[model samples]
Target: MSSTPALFRLAAACAAAALLAGCAVVSVASTAVGFAATAASLAVDATVGTAKAVGSVVMPSKAEDKQ
Candidate 1:
């Protein structure tokens, strides 16, 4: 019957919409994770720089002894 084809079309459209929505959610999640990772990396780098600065102040390098 003609109604059966219309029902099939409606079902297909709903499925496609659901698939696109799921993809959008995944994209947002991936972006958030990437931002977090970048922020963490920057924090670690800053910590390391501070430690190195402290270390240098506490113990002068042997190269400085020649000067």
Candidate 2:
């Protein structure tokens, strides 16, 4: 009967450990996805800014024409 209680405790510990490990894995994956999304957003902003700069150089603004 004592051995049965010890076995139960060991099983419970294992289950708790597995659950904690799963949580950690999920946290890491979500963090990585967040970083990737941020990086993609930055890249898109940079590309748009470059295109605008190029466009401005190719076609001067009406304000520039007035000046």
Cα-based TM-score, every candidate: 0.86, 0.83
Per-residue lDDT value at 26 in model 1: 100
Name the top TM-score candidate: 1
Steric overlap count per candidate: 0, 0
Model 1, 25-55: lDDT tens digits are 9999999999999999999999999999999
- Give candidate 1 misplaced runs (Cα > 4 Å): none
Q: What is model 1's C-alpha RMSD?
A: 1.2
**Candidate 2 per-residue C-alpha lDDT over 1-67 given as tens digits, one digit per residue, 9 for 90 to 100:** 8999999999999999999999999999999999999999999999999999999999999999998
Candidate 2's clash total is 0
Q: lDDT values of the candidates?
A: 0.99, 0.99
lDDT, model 1: 0.99
